[model samples]
Target: MDTSEFNHGHGGEPINWERAAGDNAFVFMKATQGTRYKDPWFAEDFAAASRTSLLRAPYHFFDPQSPYDAGAQARHFARTARAAGYTGQKPGELPPVLDIESALVNHRAACPPHTDARQVAALLRHIEAEFGVRPVVYTNHSFVTLCLAGDARILKGYQQWLPAYQSEPPRLPGTGRDWAFWQYTDRARVPGIPGPVDRSVYHGSLQELRSMAGIRGNPPER
Candidate 1:
């Protein structure tokens, strides 16, 4: 599951890490947005999640139309995430996530500004270089089809975290590509969280999840 400050206001209480990690194998939380803001609860929440032994990852909200350079934004995300204690070296630590949903760009407006897919890709590459681990791409179908049309190729090797709220599985953008994580619902009532929490499923076994996070040894038997 993943959360940000926006979700906290809607009956979202401080997360009970042990209770939340009971049914979840991985947890993702927003660390930074654009090039300016850091989530106030990130440091505390991250430490809590780590203490629970849930495989954890921090995501950055991408703002393609922001005035800052893409490289700058990537640096901001890496620096903030590292400062928040994401070493990308622990057994249960997953790579950083890049949130590219259209909601970040006001896509519902009458006329959304064009987002350059190349620039987005550049940011991802820069982050990968900075962190020494390939980041996961979190995006919805529409953004991939519309804003990133003809340019999705730049994201060729990255794992995808797709959100499709239907009962059916999501259809990913690239040919032969599959989802590494699937955000199945945003209104899920998880035990440790007070209100609705976005829930996702890792697309592999516990061992595979550990491997994806670059953990070296045999994972403790679940």
Candidate 2:
């Protein structure tokens, strides 16, 4: 599940973390936005998820046009996530996610004008330095084609988390890289999460997923 404070369960109820664990394999919660805004629910939600069997991860909403620069945003995200208890090195914890998409207001723009490929690459590098693991990039096809066009060589090294709402598998980016995770829907009806939740599928087997999370041995039998 890819979630933010706005995705709190129906009626503004707290998400049932234990029940979410039953229906989901992992959960990525929004931690920070730009360099100043921190998701208010992150601490509580992440602490709750830690007690469950779900793999826990944190993500940042990158504001490519921010005047604070990529390094500042990276530091903010890393610090926020660390305070929320996600280290990226913890067992069953995936690396931090860089949510580099169009700004909320520009969602329908032909090509988001705020996105910068160079800043994106710099943020990813700074995040890797802070977290000690290559960060996963959460983006869409349009963002890559229109915004990150000239940065394929820099982007190919990191994993991609794509959002493509179709039955068929998402088409690979021109970067010649395979998607690590594919979000197929934003209206998924999970048992524990009321209303709708974004659901995604990891591209590999459970064992492979564990390996990516730095877990040794096969995943525990369900």
Candidate 3:
């Protein structure tokens, strides 16, 4: 599930992490955005997920228009995630993520002029240095088509989390690279989550997923 402070259970109840674990393999939580604005729900939600069998991770919402540079944002994200207990070396903990999309910010319109591949690449590199593992990239077709021109050599090594809602798996807009994780739906109804939630699938086997989290051996029992 891809969740931020905005998502809530029925009647604004907190999500039942135990219930979520029963239905899902992993949980991606929003940690930080730009150079500040840490998700209010992130620390609590990430800690709650730790007790469950679910693999948990954090993502940063990249803002190319921010006054701070990519390095500052990366540092802020890494610090916030570290404070939230995401070490990336722990069991069931995946690497940090960069959420770069053509999305609105603080009631503003979508950003078309500020998107830069250099910034994205620099941010990813800084994050990888912090965690000692390759970070993940969460993006969509529109952003790629509008900003990245469908091909970014800098993105080749990082895992791609493509959100394309359709029956068929999505091809990475211009790169023709296979998606590592696919967010197939935003209206998925799981037992633990009251409102609609985004759900995604990992392309490889359970073992491969564990490996990505720096874990070895069999999948953790739920």
Candidate 4:
């Protein structure tokens, strides 16, 4: 759950996989390295770790500009995963995720971002079309409320992965927010990874969670 799971260069030091050995159930490795897979090393390393498991799919931090939408994201996810060496649905893994957050929502001078609900939905669709598995949407409560509220119609078919650090998720009436995974905490201690990382444990059994990630078997020792 380390937020930097998607970032490549971080102040001269890449994230330590030792952090992956914490109590967290899932480690979401960022699929994009500034808009593309962070690189084989990141994915391979996380994929190689043991203390924790990774849903090795690209994170599409959607761009609300120009052509930002779900459809565009499907292509991004599918194409990126293909480029990164991921194949069709696996038994115990979940699908890709669309990250629509501050990086994309605010576009601050310090942050490089991507956002576009329509483009994202498109990208997700494209990913599912290519892999035959659905993609999940990852975002905070505010982003969900502001950006995705109206777009739920297109996303109802997909699973929502909420990035909220709550004991229990807030009920979203009519939002159809029945989430696939609930990221319970931002602060987590994992093994194999070095330092305190943002972590999230899944709410369901290992079987249920794995099914969503599209990883058929227990990921290889990571």
Candidate 5:
């Protein structure tokens, strides 16, 4: 599960971390937007999730159209995530996520009129360089096909978090490639998270999930 500032304000309710953990939900929360905004509840929410023993990651909302340099945005995300207690030292914890979606284009006034795959690549490179592990790429199939023009080969080394809210699985762009995490529905009713929430499933076992996150040992006999 993942959440953003939009999910922390008036219309949103605080997450019941204990309940979520009990449900075996690993949580990822948005920590920054572009190169400017920071999610206000990041500190509190991150700490709460950690205390509940939930595997956690902090994601950045990438805006290729933003005037800010991709490198700068990457630096901001790294800084914000670190401050929020993501040390990138534990394999049990997920690496950062880069969320690129069509909504970035829909908000044209704030973002540029066009999307740049190169800039997106730059963001990915910077994060990987800073953290020593590749960040997960979260995007939909259409955005990958249209905006990226099916040219996101730069992200081939990283895990893909594809969101296709339908009965069937998502159709990936590149051949011989598959999703590591699939956000299958946005109307899921999970315990602890108030109202509807986006729900995702990992492609493998708990041990595989840990390995993908860069953890090397067998999962602690949980």
Candidate 6:
């Protein structure tokens, strides 16, 4: 239930792909969310981390724009993440994610801004076609309810990286779509950072996750 308190990660930490093969799942040290994206090291770190057994994905924080051009942002992400030389199996090893924050929509929607899911879907499809990999969605519970509440059709297919602060995130209820991972808490004191960091867990077995990453062969159950 200690959701807001994620994990720790700042400097360099030697990632052991095999060791990470444990239930550690993955951690998305959102670089773009802050000014960190401009630093080349962020991209390098992302690449190195993706090589590990844990599946690593990078995301962009979309701040107030029409859904029409959103796919372009995702495309830029695909290009940048790759050009930065983040190690991976091309499109499959790592997924590009869209982080829709409060200002993502022009101005705002309403008390809870409603997003055009159909447009969002087209953007996602464009990303997949352009990059050969499907993108994941990251959102807080509040924004999710506001924007994606009624758009179950597309939500069900994509991976949901939900941030449920101070409480355990809601799991897939009667909804068949299962959450691939849960960002349970932040400030986990994970080795590498100056301060604390954010930590999360994959909803399924490591092998299943690997499969999602297109590892080709099946991995053992962790």
Instruction: Please report the candidate that would top TM-score against the real structure.
Output: 2
Tens digit per residue, CA lDDT, model 1, 29-92: 9998877889988888898898986889999988755533678888888888888788777767
Per-residue lDDT for 1-222 in model 4, tens only?
644543334443455555544444555566553233344454555455422454544455555444444454455556666665565455334566666554442553222234435555566666667777676767555554565553455566666677666566654434565766677765555554445556655667765666665545553443
Tell me the lDDT of candidate 3. Answer: 0.82
Instruction: For each candidate, give its TM-score against the true structure.
Output: 0.89, 0.91, 0.90, 0.69, 0.86, 0.69
Question: In model 2, where do residues sit more than 4 Å from their true spots?
Answer: 65-68, 104-107, 110-114, 169-173
Backbone clash pairs for candidate 3 read: none
Tell me, by lDDT, which candidate is best. Answer: 3
Report every candidate's CA lDDT: 0.79, 0.81, 0.82, 0.55, 0.76, 0.55
User: Lowest lDDT 10-mer window, candidate 4?
Assistant: 108-117
lDDT of 2 by residue, 1-222 (tens): 987887785456788889888877888899998879998889999999899988879999887555348999999999998998788998889989998775444456344445576787889899999999999888876666667663455578778888878664454455676788998899998776778889999999988888777788977777
Which pairs of residues collide in model 2?
none
List candidate 5 segments past 4 Å from native: 9-12, 65-68, 104-114, 214-222
Which has the higher lDDT value, candidate number 1 or candidate number 6? 1
| lDDT, model 2, position 83 | 92
lDDT of 6 by residue, 1-222 (tens): 111112223344444334443545555544443212343445655655656655666666554245365565556665666666643355335566666543434665442232555655666676677656667777654554465663345656778777655776774332356566677666555433435556677777766776776666766455
lDDT of 4 at 113: 32
Q: lDDT, candidate 4, residue 61?
A: 56
lDDT of 4 at 203: 64
